[model samples]
Target: MKKVLMGMAIASSLATMMFVPNQAQAAVEANIGATSNYLWRGVSQSADSASVSGGIDYSDDSGFYAGTWVGSLGDGNGAETDFYLGFGGESGDFGYDVGYILYHYADLDDGDFGEVYFNGSYADFSFGVAYTVNSQVDDGSLFDTGDIYYSVGYGFEVAKEYSVGLTYGYYDFDAGSDSDYGHLQVDISKGDFTFSVSRADEDSGDDDTKFVVSWGTTF
Candidate 1:
């Protein structure tokens, strides 16, 4: 499964390169940061611990972009690396993004997956859907493929350089019981540095709530 997804990713990249014009004019940017906890789809990825991450991104004037990011995930999971490519543009007050992302886990067998997503935003509100294209396990198997996630978020400025955001998401497994969760976040920015505090709700179990504080900067 990993081999097949890697091949498709390469083919897609090649196709983009063949059609995109003036690729050399693209803008490149890099960022590094640390998070109190690595969370994905409202679930913890770092065993409820802190994580350091970094990534570089390239964006063209034609709304095509690609990037790779990596985050540390302890508990013998090593690192989680993600490769993504997408195109996004705005139309009047609405914006749309479509993309594919592959999640790879270092030092872990049968732990890679791929997803395709589409997102749209109107003003300060956004909504999106993502579907699992393939998983580490073979296709056509329950819980391995055909899973879907839906999310909605809204953000607004509370004061100068301060903002608050709320998000809710639902994960519907193809084989297991569904899960739903929400997140609330507050952010403050000073120059290139941003501080954030976030709280997320767990879908099940006794530890139903989790909070994290983090600081990050971009260069």
Candidate 2:
């Protein structure tokens, strides 16, 4: 329980740049943003603690992109930073992404974990599958520890400056263990600033609910 809470806190401290647009033939973008909770694919990326994350991206029109991102996390294991390298492409309404997620700890007792993920999005719906290549799980013997997740989201315009959305995802892992999560989000934009609020829920034996709020700007 303490570890979970600490993860969330570290997630909130890491500011990260996501959703970079490639307008020019060869484009590069730098970004920095923070979120109250680090939720990735319906699972808490942070230890249920606040986390801040950020990174930069470079992309080309040939459908190749690469970037690195880092964040702080809370855990007795001492690994407080995470880094990832990924590539993604969009073909009309369909898109595909593949990346590596690496968890680096500072303590010796806790080892690092790395995973690979592939994701697809069509219109407002997205789905993905992930595999732990070098799972730093407590027990390294856990093999074939893969995860599947899917999400669907649509946005509604409210007034000229406000919009709301509903997003949901389902996660299933090895054995019969599975979890479902949903989010209700609202976005308000004025000029160069955008503010958002989201509520996330996880349905499982240890169900957890969280509320997140964030403010960001785009160049």
Top TM-score hit: 1
Residue 42 Cα positional deviation in candidate 2, in Å, after optimal superposition: 4.4
How much lDDT does each candidate structure score? 0.60, 0.49
**C-alpha lDDT (0 to 100) for residue 149 of candidate 2:** 41
Candidate 1 accuracy as TM-score: 0.78
Q: Could you tell me the TM-score of candidate 2?
A: 0.66
Over 176-199, each residue of candidate 2 has an lDDT whose tens digit, in order, gives 453334444444544433454445
Candidate 1: give its CA RMSD in angstroms: 7.4
Residue 108, candidate 1: Cα error in Å is 1.6
Candidate 1: residue 180 lDDT (0-100): 38
